[model samples]
Target chain A: IIGMMAMTLSSVAADHLPSWNEGATKRAIIEFVENVTEEGSPGFVPPSERIAVFDNDGTLWSEAPLPFQAAFAFDEVKRRVPTEPALAADPMVKAMLDGDIGKLLEGKHHDGLMRILALTHAGMTTDEFDRRVNQWAESASHPRFKRPYLELTYQPMQELLDYLRSHQFECFIVSGGGADFMRVWSERVYEIPPQNVVGSTAQVRYEMRDGKPVLIKTLDQLFVDDKEGKPVGIHQFIGRRPIACFGNSDGDQAMLEYTTIGNPHPSFGLIVHHTDAEREYAYDEKPPASGKLTTALEAAAARGWTVVDMKRDWNQIWSNPDAASN
Target chain B: IIGMMAMTLSSVAADHLPSWNEGATKRAIIEFVENVTEEGSPGFVPPSERIAVFDNDGTLWSEAPLPFQAAFAFDEVKRRVPTEPALAADPMVKAMLDGDIGKLLEGKHHDGLMRILALTHAGMTTDEFDRRVNQWAESASHPRFKRPYLELTYQPMQELLDYLRSHQFECFIVSGGGADFMRVWSERVYEIPPQNVVGSTAQVRYEMRDGKPVLIKTLDQLFVDDKEGKPVGIHQFIGRRPIACFGNSDGDQAMLEYTTIGNPHPSFGLIVHHTDAEREYAYDEKPPASGKLTTALEAAAARGWTVVDMKRDWNQIWSNPDAASN
Candidate 1:
C-alpha cells in the first residue's frame, strides 16, 4: 500500500502543472505538447513552427470588476484630474472615477471613452508611456484579490507557458488590451517578452522634439486585437499561424477557429471555462463583461476543442498551491 | 618563406566576410557583433536583444530602373487589361503600361495610384494575396539584371544576415514595400521569416464568406512604412528597439535614428552608399528614386554611423564568389 502511494505521489510530483488537476483537460495539453515535440512522431512540429498564442485578460488572470487596462486608465484619469480641474469636471472623468460602467456604456460613451483614452494613453512619448506602465504595474493592486495585479495571473497557465517554452515552443500573448501596457510588465509577470505581445495599438507618430526624434502616441486607434481581429493580429505580427491557442471568451472564438480549423498540421485549441466562483469569477453562458462565451461554448463541442472547467480542472488558480486545500 | 606564405593564406581564409574588403566598415561590424555577443563583456547583449533591422529596397537588393513592386503592379495591369476593357481605358492604367512615370507623378497621380493599388493589391483575401505574391515572386524578373528579382539581392548583405544570425542575432527586414509581398519569399530569399518582416500594410477586414472566415485586403492605405513611419512600423511589429540598423537611404534615416540614437545599449548603425555604377547603380548624392540620401549622408559621419561605400568596400556584389574575377 505504501509503495502504491509513493508511486502515485511520484507521478503527481512529475506533473509539470502542479496547479492543474489530473484529468482529460490536463492530459490533452500534455499529450499535444508531447506529440508535437517527439522527434519521430507524425505530428512532430519543428521548433520554428512551434508557436503558441494565449489571450490575456480573463484567460491569464482575473478580469473581474473590470479589465485591468480599464482600471489603469481610470487611475490615470484620477491622478491627472487633480492638476487639471477641467478634466475632473468632465462627466466621463467623473463616471470613470466612480467606477460607473453604466454611464460609460451609454451611446455617448464612445466619445467619452475616446476622451479618456486620449487623455490617459496619448500625448506622451513611447518611452514615457512604457515607464508609466511599469510604474503602474509595480504599485497597482487588484481590488477584490487585494494583491498586486501582476500576481493575479493563473498559476496553471504560467506553468503551461514554461512547459511549452521548455519544449522549444515560442509563446506569444495575443490580447485585446493595450499592447504597450502589457509589454511593459509581460516579461516580468509572464516570461513572455515585449516582442511577443500583440494587442490593440494607438497611432504613434515619429517627430523631432527638441532636435531629437521621439515617437508620440496619438489619440487615433490603429488596430484592435479582438474577435476576428485576433487571427489577423496573429498573422500581422507573427506572420505564422499558431498551432496551439488558449483563450477564454467569445472574443477568442474566431482565433480558435482559425487555429484548429483548416490547418494542415495538427493543432490544439483550449478554452478556460471560468466555473470556479470561489477561486475565480464564473461567467460562461452569460457574462457581464465583454468576454462573452455563448457562441464559442456552443461550438467548442462540435470543433473538438477542450473546454477546461476551471472548478474541476484547476486544483489551484493563483500562484498559491495550497489555495484549494485552504 | 613557405611557412609565412601558408600563415598568410590561412589568415585570409579566416575572414568571415570574403565579399567585404579590408576596411573600417567590415571591422566595425565584426567588432560590434563580437563585443555584444562576448560573455561577461560590458557591451554584451543577450541573444533576445540582439535584433538587427535592415531596409529592403536598395540595401538588400537593386531598386534601380524603378522599384520591383512598381514593375509587378505594371505587369498586373497589363495582364488584367484584357479581361476588363474599362480598366484598360483608365488613364492610370494607360500611364502605367506606357511607362510614362511623369504623368503618374503629377498631382492627380494620387487617385490613379490608389486605383492601381486597389486593382492590383486589394479585393482579395489575405491567403489569396499571399498566393498571388508567391506566384509573382516565382515569375518576376528584373528588367536591368535580366534575372529573377530575388537574385538581384546584394551578396554582401546576404553574408551580413548570415553572420548576424550565426552570432545569435535576430534579423528583421523593415521595408517600405508591402509586408505580404515580401513575406511570400523572404524566408527562401533572405532566410528572414515572415514574422521578422515589417513593412507597409494594407487595411485587412475580417469577414465570413460562405461559412469561411477570411481576412480581405481593402483599398485603403493603412500605413506607409517609410521615413517617419519606419520607426512606428518597427515598434508596432517588433515591439523592441533593435541593436543594429542598416539602410541605404533617407527613407530609413528615422529607423536608424530610432535604433541607435537614444538606445541605452551599445548599438551600431550602417548606411550602404551605392557608389558602383558599373556593378550596381550609384545614386547616393543625387539619385532618381525616392531613397535619396542627402541629409542622412551628411548626418551619418556626425552620428558615428559607418557609411559603406559599395564600390570600394565590397569585393563582390553578386552571389557568385568569382563575379569580381569575371
Candidate 2:
C-alpha cells in the first residue's frame, strides 16, 4: 500500500503541466509530443524541425478589457497629448482618449485604430521606441487583475512552452500585436527571443543621424500580421511551416490551416477557448475587447484540433510567483 | 629536440584558420573575438548578444564569369523556353539567351535582369520553387573553377564562421541575394539556417489549393535588400543591432555602418578586398559581375575597418574537401 502511494506521489510530482487538469486536452498534447519525440515512430520529427507557434493576446494571456497593445497605445496618446497638443486634432486620438473602442474599430479593416497605432508606435527612432515600450512594460498593470500587465501570461501556456522546450521544440509567438511592442518584453516574459516574435511591422528607414547610424520608425509601409497575414508572416520570418500551432480567435484560422493541412510531418493544433467568465472573461463571437473567436472555434472539432476550456482544463490560470519549480 | 618539434606541430594544429596567413587582418579578428568573449574583459559581451552578420555572393563565395543566381536563372530560361516559348519574347530573355550581358545590365537598377528574375522566380508554388532550386544546386558548377558552385565558398571565411561560432556568436547572412534562393542551401553550405538568412524577398500569397495549403510566389512588393535596405532587413528580422559585420562590396556599406557605428556593444567590421586575380577574380570599381566596392573601399580606412587583400591575407581560396577539420 505504501509503495503504491509512493508511486502515485512521484508520478504527480513528475507532471510537467501541473496547472493542467487530467482531461482529453491534456492527453492530446502529451500524445502528440510523445509521437513526434519517439525516435523510431513513423510520426517522428527531427529536433531541428520541431517548430511551434502561439498567438499572444487571448491565447497566452488575458486579452480582455482591452488588447494590451491597444491599452498601451491609448495610454500613449493620453500622455503625449499634453506635450504634442496637435495629436488631439486626429479623431482617432480623440476616440482613443474617450475610450471609444467601437468608434476606433468601426471600419472592417479598423482604419481609425490603425491610424492611432501609427501615431503612437511610429515617428521615433527604433531605439527611442524600444525605450518607450520598456518604460510602459515596467509601469503598466492589468485594470482588473491589478497585477503588472506582463504577469497576466497564462500559467498553463507558460508550462506548455517549457514542456515543448524540454522536447527541443523552438516555440515562437506569432501574434497580431505590434512586433516592436512584443519584442520589448518577450525575452523576459516568455523566454522567447526578439527574433522569435513575429508580429505586425512598420517600415524602419536606415539613416545617419549626427555621424551615427540610426533606424527611424515610420508609418510608410505597415504589414498587419493578422488572419491571412499570420501564415505569410510565418513564412517570411521563420521560412518553414510550423508543425504545431496554438491560438484563440479568428485571427489564427489561417495559421492553424497552414500548420496542420497536408503537413508532411505529424501536426498538432490546439485552440484555447476562453470559457471562464468568472475567472477570466469568456466570449466567442463578441468580447469586451478584440479576439473574436467564432470561426476558429467552429472549425476546431472538424479539424481534430484540441479545444481547451480555460476554466475546466486549467486548474490554475496565472503562474504562482512563489513556485520553486523552473 | 623531438619534444620541442612536437610542441611546435601541435601549436600549428591548434590554429583555427588554416587558410588565413599571418597578417594584421587575422590578428584583428583574433583580438576582437577574444575581447568580446573573455569573461573579465571590459569589452565582454553575453553569448546571446553576440551576433555576427556576413554578406553572401562575392563575400562568401565566388560571383564571377556570371553570378551563380544569374547562371541558374539563365539556365532556367533555357530549360523552360522549349515548353513555354512565351518566355523567349521578353527582351530580358533575348539578352540572356544571346549572352548580351551589357544589354541585361543596361539600366541603373538592372530593371531588365529583374524582370527576367520575376518571370523565372515567381508564378510557382513555394514548395515547387524549393524543389527547383535544390535540383539546380545539385547540378550547377562554376564556369571558371570547373567545380560545384557550392564548393567555391571561401575557405578563409568558412573558417571565420566556425571560429566566431566557437565563441558562441550566432552568425547570420545579410545579403542582396534572394532569401528564398539562399535559404535552400544556406544551412548545408554556411551552417546558417533559413531564419538566419535575411535577403531580398518577393511577395508570397497563402492560398488553399485543392484543400492543401500553398504559398504562391509573386513579383508584387519586391523588396530588394541592398544598400540601405540591408539595415532595415536586419531590424525587421533580427530585431537588434549586430555587433560584427562582414562584407566585400558597396551594397554592404550601410549594414557595416549600422553594425559598428555607435553600437552599444564592442563591434568589429571587416571588408574582403579581392586582389587575387590568379586564384580568385579581383575587382574593385569593376568586376566580372556586380559587387562594386568604390564607396565602401574609400570609407574603410577612415572608419578603421579592417580590409583584407585576398592575395596577402589568404593562403588558400577554397576549402579542401578532404580536410579533417570542421
Candidate 3:
C-alpha cells in the first residue's frame, strides 16, 4: 500500500509542479537541482552536501493580516488575561488587545513582542507547549483566507520542497518564527520534519517535575533567527553552508548573502516578491512598516538571484486555485 | 572504484570490531544494533529515525593531559601574545601561562575557560576560525601519548560509528567541546559531518568584511553543552529523540536519562568507564573534579545502561594495538 502511494506521489512530482508556471523561476530552480545532483557534472554536490534552506513567513505562507505567530500571541493574551489579572494590566498586553502594532513598534518592536511572547509562550513544559501549539494550529484560521493558517502555505514552494527532497537534498526551514511553534506543524504542513526546522528560540531550562525531566520555556530570548542573526543561526544549527536559500523580505537578505556570496560551489538564491495583490497581500515594495523589500528586490538582479514574481511565476498560489476572497 | 572501496570497507566490518575484545560489551552492542535494525521486529526503528549521539571528549577520543581544545587555547595565547600584548597581560592568560589550573578552577572554572577561549577562539571570521582549528589539530600532539591528538581516537568507537552508519544510522557528536573546533576535523576523523555535530558554542555575529560576508565569533557564551545542558543541546540541535546515546562522564547522565528514561521505543545507553590506566588515563571514578562518574556509575546498572570497563572490554584501544611507551 505504501509503495503504491509512493509511486503515485513520485509520478505527480516528475513533471507537474502544478502550482508553478513554466517560467524563468521554475526553470532556474530545476536547472540548479539537476546540476548539483548529476553525478558526472562539475557542479555535482554529493547528497551529504545537498542542504537547502527556506524562510517560513511570506516565502512559505501568508504573513499578512499579521504573522500567524503574532496572531497566536494576541489570542493567548486574551485567553490567559481572565485568570492573570496582572497580565491584563501589563502595557504590552494592553497594546496587543488594542490591536496597536504602531504603539508596539514605538520602542523596539522585538522588545514589545518578547514581552507578550514571554507571558503567552513561557513557563509551560515543552511537551505541554507543543500540545497547545498543535491544537491552536489545527483550529486557527487566517482572517483573510478563512482557512486554517497551515493551509495558507504556498503550493509552489511546497512543490519545490518536495522536488528538492526527492533529489536527495535535505530541506530545512530557517525561519525567524518560534522554533517550537514551527516544529508543531512543519512536518504535516510542509513535509519538512522537525529536525530540519530551525528558527528563533526562547531560553529553556531543564528541570525535574514530579520526578520527570521537563524543559520549561523561559522569558529570555535565546537567539533571534532574523536579519544578521539568520546567517549566525544557520551556522549555529545547520553547521554546513547551504547551497540554496529561499526567502522574502529585507530580513532574509543577510541569509541570502551568506549562502551565495563567495561560496565556491554552484549556489542559488531566490527572492519571493509579493507582486500579486489580487491573489495575496502585496506590501513588500510599498509597506507601511514591515518587510520593506525595496533594497533586496533591486539587489537581487545584480546578485544573480532569481526574483520570483508571484503574479507571473506561479500558476496558482494555493492548493485550491480559486480566487482568494479578501 | 567507489563501489569497490565501499565493498572492501564493508568486508572488514563484517566480523569483530578489531579493537574490541570478544565479551559482553561487544556482544551487547552488536545485539542492540541488530535488534533495533531487524525488519518486522518490535524493536525496529526506521532508517530516518535511527539517530545515535556520541559524546566527543573521552568517549570518541582521549581528553587526558587536558582536552585538546584547552591545550589549543594555551598554545593560541602564547602564539597571539606577540602580536597583541594586551592579551599577554590578561589574568586568564597569565594564569594559563603559569599552568595554574588551581587559579582557573577557583570561583568559576567555566568563566575562566571562556575568557581564554574568547581571546583565542573569537573575533575571527568563522571560515578563518575553522582554518586555524584545522591547522592546530594537525600539528598538536598529546603530551604523554606523543602523537597527534586526533590519532588518540579509540579504534573500537570508530568501528562502532562505522557499524552504526552501515546499519543506516545517522551518527551525531553531541559534545561539550566548541562546535567550531569540532567542525574543523570531525568529518575527516570521525565521519561525522559539521551538521551532525552539536556542541557548546560562543555567540557569533554576521558582518561584511571587505565586501565579503563573514560570521564573526563573539566573546559571549551561547551555550554550554554539558551536564543538564547536554539534553537541552540535543533537543535544540537534533530535534529527534535519539534511540542510543554514548558517553563516558557524569556530564552525559542527563542526556542518557532524557534519551532512554521516558522513551517508549527500545533504547540503549553505553558508558565507557576508563579503567585501563596503561592504555589511557583513568580519572572518572576518582577525578580532580572534571567528569566525576560516581553518580552515573551507580545509576548505570539500575538503568540497564551498559558500562564498558576499558581494561576488560577491549583487547586493544588504539588502532595500532601496540603498547605505547612514554
Candidate 4:
C-alpha cells in the first residue's frame, strides 16, 4: 500500500517536477517515505503531522552568486531604464542593468541588498509584475550555464517534492525572496502553486478601481522572509508548525529551528550545502552577495539537521539538463 | 492497512478535537475517509491531491451576532476607555464600549465593520495583541449559551479537520475575521496552530526597538478574507487549491467554487446550513448578523457542493453540553 501510494504521488509529481534524477536523493526520499507510511513503523507519521517546508532559491533549485529571482529583477530594471535616467545613474541599479554581477555584489550587507530589492520590485500591480517575470524567464539566460535561468533548477529536489507529496506531506516554498515573485513561476517549475509559496512581500492595498475591487501594491515595506522572518512567516501564514524543512542558507535557520521544535513525532530538517562546483557553483557560510548561511551551520549541527553535500549526495543536478543545454 | 491508517489518523484527530460526538457526523467522516484512501475507488485520492479548506466561524465554532474576536475587541476597548473620554463620546467607540451589539451592526457593511475593527484592534505590538486575545478567550462567555464562547465549537467539524488530516488532507481555516485574532485562539480551540489560519489582516511593520526586531500593527487595511477574497486568500496563503471545502454562508461560496474546480477526483464540498434554532440558532439567507447562505445554496446545487443541514446532519452540537449544564 505504501509503495502504491508512493508510485501514485511520484507519477503526479512528475507531471510538474520532471527534474529529479533517480538515485540517492530519490532512494533516501522513498525510504523515509515508506517508513512514515508503512503501518506500525516507529517513523509512522499521521497525515496531519505530515507538514513539509522547503526553501525556494537553493534547496529546490540553484542560487549561486545571487538568487535567480534577484537576477531577474536586475535584468528587468536594466530593460525598463530607457525612460528612467535616475535609476540608470544609480550605482546598484546600473550594475544590475549592465549584468555587472561583480559590482552588484560590492560592499552590500543583507539589509542593504533587501532595501535595493524593495525599491526595485515594490509598487507594481501583481499582474504587471507576473507578466514581467514570465517574459524575463522566457528570455533571460544564466551567465555560467548559458541557459534560461528557469532551467537551472535541481532535478533531485523536484523528485523529492513529488516523493514526499505521495506520502501525505504538505510542501511549501519558504524563502527570503518576494512571495509574489516566486509564486508567479513556482507552479511551472516546482508544481507548488501560488498559494503554497511563502516569502517576502511588499504592502498591497485593496481598492475599487472603476467599480472593480483590485489589490494594488504600495510603496511600503512588509516583512522580508529570511533568517528570523522565516519562522515568523511560517507561524503567521501557515498557522500550523511544519514537520519537515529544507533550506540552504542562514536565512533559513529560523525555519529549521521552528520545524525541529515540533513535538510527538520527530521532525526532519535538511540543508543543501553547495559543494558541487562543477555542476553548480559551490560556496558556504558566505556567498558574494548575501552572507545568510554562515551563522546557521553550528545551529544546524546542534539541531541535527541533515546537511546534503551537493557534489556527493546528488548524482544529477537538475531534471532537464538536455533541454537546458540546448 | 487502510483501516489502521484511518484509525491512527482518527486517534490523533480525537486528541485535538475531543468535542466530536460519535455518530453520523463521525460515520460520514469515516465514509469520506475510506473512499479517499481505499485503493482503486473512484473517490480514492492521493495525499498530494488531498487539500482541505475549512471555514473558521460558525462552521468551526460559533460566531453569531458578532464574531468572538469582535467581542474581545469590544471588551478590550471598554476596559481601556475609563481614562479616555474621547472614545466615550465617539458613537462607534461608545457603542462598542456600552456593549451595544446592535449599534455595532447598524448601517455597517463588511468593509465598514472591518475599518472599525482596524481602529479598535491596531496600534499594539504583536505580543500585546496576542495577550489580549488570550485573556479575552479565557473569560468571555456567549450571551445565549452562557458558556465561555471558546467552548461553543461545532464538535463534528473539529472531527472533520482531524479526519481529513488523517487521510492526508491539508486543512486550513479561511475566514473573513482578522487573521492574527483567530490565530491566537485557533490552536487552543481547534488544535490548528496559527500558520493554517488565513483571514483579514491590518498592515504590520517590522521595526527594531532596543536592539530587538518586532512586528507592530498599523491601521492600514491589508487583505480581507471573505466572499471573493476567500479564494484569493487561499491562493495567496495555501498556494495549493483545496480538494475539499467546508463553509456556511455566501462568504464561503468562492472557496467552495475554488475547491470544486480542482482536477476531477472524488472531491467533496460541504455547506453547513444552520437549521437547529433550539440547539444552535437556525437562519439562512436572511439573518442580520450571520445570515447570507442564499447564493451558496444555489451555487452548491449547481456546483454539486453538499449542503449539510446542521439540524439533520449533526447528532449533537457542542462537545460537552451535558458538562455545561452542570
Candidate 5:
C-alpha cells in the first residue's frame, strides 16, 4: 500500500507538471526529484539540504525586447535626462534614451549600462528606490506581450518552483538583476520571499536622518551577480551549495557547474533553451537581447544536464498568456 | 476560555523561561512575545515578518577572552608562522600571537584585527576554511572557562531563542563575527541555520580548478558587520527590517535602533548586560573585552528597550556550565 502511494505520488502526469509536456525533459526533472525526495532512497536528501536555484530573466520570465530591469534603468535614464541635462553628456544616456541595447552592452563590464543604472538606481534612500520600483511595476508593461513584466513569468518554471517547494526544496532566485529591483515584487509574483533573493547589490550605507534610520544606496562598489559571481553570491548569501540549478544563459554557467559538478548529494541541472518563436520570442542562432546561450548550451550535453527546448517541452508559455486580465 | 489558555501559555513563571527569575525583565520579554504571537491582537505580527535577530558573541555565548573568530584567526596565524616564518614580519601577526587585545583593537576599523583575520581567513578555498573551522572547534576550549567554546552558550539566552522560535519567530544571528565561523556550528549550538546568519563577509571569487568549481576566499571586499555596519549587513543579507533585536554592546546600537524606531510593527529590543562577576565575567566601569555596552546602555531607557541585569535576572548561566560532560 505504501509502495502504491509512493508510485502514485511520483507519476509525471499526476497533474504536477501540467505546463510541462510528456517529454524526456519533464521525465528527467521528475526522476531527479523522486530520487532525491523519496524516503530511504540512496539519493535521498533531507529537506534542509535540498536547495534549488533559478536565474530570473531568461529562465523564470521573458527577457526579450529587453530584460525588465534593463528596461527600467533605460526608462529611468530617459526620464532623468530632461531634468538633469548634465546626464545627457554621457553617450550611455543617449544610447539608453534611444533603446540601443547593443551600445549599452558593448563594454566588458557593460560600463555604459552600469553608468545609466547608477544614475537611476543609486544615490537615493532604499525606501525611495523601493517606492519607485513599486510604482513603476504597476505601470510598466512588456513591449511585445503588452502585460506587466511580473505577469510574463514562465508558467512551467513557476510550476517547477511549486513542485520543488512541495518536496521542501528551498528555492532561491540567483539573478544578475539588482537585489532591490527584484525584491519589490518577488514575493507577490514568484512566492519567493525577499530574504531568499541573491542578486546584484550596491554599496548601501546606514544613516540616522531626522530620528529615522535609512539605508542610502550609493553609486560605488556594485557587486554584479553575473557569470562567475553567481556561485560567489550563492556562497555569500545562501551559505550552502544548491543541489538543483536552473538557468538559461552563459551568465548562469558557473552557478550550474557549482550546483551539480562533484556535489556529494545527488544534484540536478536544467537549461531553458529558447526554441519557441511563435508563443514567445526566440532566436535562430543566438539570443539577441540578454541570454546569449553559447558555451553553456554546448557544455550541457556532456554534463548530463537536462536542456528544455521551450517549444518542445513546454505546453504553455506565460502563466497569464492573455495579457489583458493579468 | 481562549483568554484563559492564552494567559496560561504566556505566564513568565511557566516552563518556557525557567532560567529567568520572576522579575520585570522576564515579564517584559514574555509580554512582548504574547503581544506579537497572539492572533487578533493589535500588536499581532504575521509569522513571515516575525524576524528576531540576535548578536552571536556576547549575546549568545561568552566573548571575554576574545571573540571565537579572533581566537581562530590567532591560532591559525600561530600555526602558519611555524611554516611561513615571514608571517611574523607583520606587527598585527605579532600582536595576535601575544593576544594583546588593546593593540589589536586600537584602530578605527580595528586594522590590526582585520589584518590578522585576512592572514588566516583568506587566500584559501572556502571548503578548506570550513574544514579548518570544524577541526579547530573540536579541540579549541576557552582559556578561563576551560570548556569547548560551543558549550559556553548562555542557558537563559538559549531558552529565549527556543521560546521565540516556538512562537513562530524566525531567529537570525546578526553578529560582529565572521559569517563562515558562525555558520559552521550555529545550527548545532543556537539552532540558527547558516542561511539565517548575517555577519562580516570577505570577498570570495568563483573559479574552476581542475574540472571543479571552487570559491576562492579573497581578502579584498571585507564587510565588517560592526557598529553601523550591522544594519547595513542586515539590509544586504536579510533584505527586510527586523521587528525584534537582541544584542549587547555599542556594536549593536544601530541594529537596535533600526529594528525598533520608525518600525510600523510593535518592536522589541533587548540588551544583555553582563552584570555578574562570579557566575559570568563582568566589568564595573568599562567592559574589559569585546562587548562594551556604553552608548546603547545609556540610550536604552529612552528607547524602551529591556536591559537584562545578568546577576539579578538570571538564576543560571551556561547551559552546560560543567565542562567535563559537554
Candidate 6:
C-alpha cells in the first residue's frame, strides 16, 4: 500500500508535464511561467494579475494558404455551388469552388478579401451559416496535408496552451476569422469554448421570427478583427490588457503592442514565424493567400517580441501520434 | 551551510501555495489545476485548453446598493447639478442632489436608470465624459462606508484573482456597467487592465477632427450589459464560454448559466451573497436599488453554484484594511 501510494504521487507529479524539449522556446515558456507563478521569483505575478491572450489562426493552429475559416468558406462555396449553378462559371466563385485559393487571392489586398467575405458570407442567418461551417469542417480535408483541416493544428502550440492553463493562465483566442465559425469547433479543438473567442463579425439584428426572438446577421459591417482593428477588438471584447500575447501575423501587431504597453511586471509577446516548409509550408512577408504578415514582423523585432522559428523550436508539428507513427 | 540550504528549500516549497486554507474552495481550485495540468489526471486539460472568465461588479469587488459605476454617475450628476440649477429643482434631480438614492430610484426600474444615465452621460464628448468619470471616481466616497468608492473592493476577492492567476487562469471583468468607465480604474483596482473589461456603452461614432480621426459617443443606445444581455455581451465580447464564473446578482445569472451549460468538466459558478447587515447592508428579494440576490441565490442553489456567505467565509472585507480602522 505504501509503495502504491508513493508511485501514484510520483506518477502524478511526473505526469504534470513530460519534460519540454530544451531550447529558447522552452526556456522562454518556463521562465515566464516561473516568474509569473513562483511567489518569490523576480517575475512572480499574482493570480489576479495573470492574463494571457493568443491569436487563433496561425499561432494556435494553421493559417497556411488562408485562415481555416476562409478554407471553410471555400469548401462551403463548393458545396453550395450545385444549388447555384451560375457559381460554377462565376470567376470569384469558380476560384473558390475549384480550390484555386491562391488564384482567388492573387494580387488582392486584405480589403479585397473582406469584400469577398462580405459577399460570400452575408445575407444568411447566423444559424444557417454556422451549420454550413460545421458541415464543411466535418467533411473537409486540407488539399496539401490530406488530413482533416482540424488535424492541421500545431502540436507544440497545443502543449503551450495546456502548460499555461495548468499555471492559472487565462487564455483567449483573438482572431480575424468569423466569430460564429470559430466558436463551433474551438471548444472541442482548442478547449476554448465559444464565449472566449473574439473575432470579426457582421452586425447582428435582433428580430421576432414566428413569435420567437432571434439574433440574425445583417449585411452591415460591425468591426473587422485585424490590424488596427485588433486593439479595438481587444478593447471592445476582452476589456483588459493581456500581460502575455501570441500571434503569427502582422494583423496581431496592435494586439501585441497593446498587451506590452505599461505592464508593470514581466510580460511576454510571442510571434510564431513559419520557417518550416516540409512539416508545414513556410512563407512570410506575404502569405500564400490573402493573409499578410509584414508589419507585425518589423514591429516584433523592433519591440523585442519573441519570434518563434518553427523549424528550429518544434520537433512535432501536429497533435496526432499518427504523424510520428507514419 | 546545510541548515541554510534546508531553509531555502523549505521556503521554495512553502512558496508553492501549499499553505492556502484547506477546504472545498482550495480543493476545487487545486483539483482543477491538477486535472488541467497533471497529464494523468482524468480531467487533465491541455494548455491550449485553458480559458477562464470572471464577472466584475460583485465578484471582483462590491456592488452593494448600486453598482460602482452607478455610484459614480450619481456623484457626477450631483457635481454637475450646480452648473444646471434649473434642473436641480426637478424632483429626480432634487432627490439625486439631496443624496436620497432610495428616492431617486423609487418606482424606477432599469429603463428609468438608463434614461437618467443617458441624459446625464450622453451629449458630452468621449474625452469630457472620461475625464469627468475619472475626476468623480478619484474623489467620490461610498455613502455608508465613507471610503473612496473604489476602495470598497473586497480584498479576499483580489487574493482569489491572484491565486487563480498564479495557477495561469486568465481573468476578465464582465460587468453591466459602462465599458469605458470600468476600463479607467479596473486595471488599478483588480489589476485587470482596460482591455479585459466588457460592459454596456452608448453608441460611438468614428470621425475626423483636427485632421485626426477619433471615436466619439452618441446618445444612441448600443448595448446593455445585464440579464440576458450578459450572455449576449459575453458572446459579442469574450467570444468563448468560461470554465469559471462569479457574480452576485440576477444580471449575472445568464452569464453563469451560459458558462456552465453543456460543459463536461468540473466548471464553477460562485455567487457572493451579502449577508452581513452590520458590516455591510444586507437585503434580498427587494426592488429598485436593493442589491440583486434573490434569483441568483435560487439559481445558484439549483445549479450547485458556490454561494459565498460574506459574513461567514470572509475574514476580511475591502482592500483598504484601514477604512474601519480610521
CA error at residue B236 for candidate 2, angstroms: 0.4
* Tens digit of per-residue lDDT, candidate 6, span B237-325: 65545677888878787778766655555577888777777777565676336356777788676787877777766666777544222
Q: Choose the strongest candidate by DockQ.
A: 5
* Per-prediction fnat: 0.52, 0.70, 0.58, 0.28, 0.73, 0.27
Judged by whole-model lDDT over C-alpha atoms, candidate 3 comes out at 0.81
Model 5 DockQ reads 0.77
DockQ of each: 0.47, 0.70, 0.50, 0.18, 0.77, 0.16
**Candidate 4, A160-276: lDDT as tens digits:** 787787777878888887887887778777778666788886555544456333455554546668877786677567655677889988888767776775345667778888887
- TM-score for chain B considered on its own, for each of the candidates: 0.91, 0.93, 0.91, 0.85, 0.93, 0.83
* lDDT of predicted model 5: 0.86
- Pairs of residues clashing in candidate 1: none
For model 1 chain B, the run of ten residues with the poorest summed lDDT: B317-326
Alpha carbon lDDT at A20, candidate 5: 93
Candidate 2 DockQ, CA atoms: 0.70
Sum up the clashes in candidate 1.
0
- lDDT string for model 5 (A128-189, tens) is 99988877787888887788877889989988988999889999999999998999888888
After superposing candidate 2 on the true structure, give the runs of residues whose Cα lies further than 4 Å from its correct spot: A1-14, A322-326, B1-14, B107-109, B322-326
* Docking verdict class for candidate 5: medium
Model 4, docking class: incorrect
- Residue-level error in angstroms, candidate 2, position B184: 0.7
lDDT of 3 by residue, A146-180 (tens): 99877888888878887888888899999988888
Which has the higher lDDT value, candidate number 3 or candidate number 6?
3
Q: TM-score for chain A of every candidate model?
A: 0.91, 0.92, 0.91, 0.83, 0.93, 0.85
Model 3 reproduces what portion of true contacts? 0.58
**Candidate 2 backbone overlaps, count:** 0
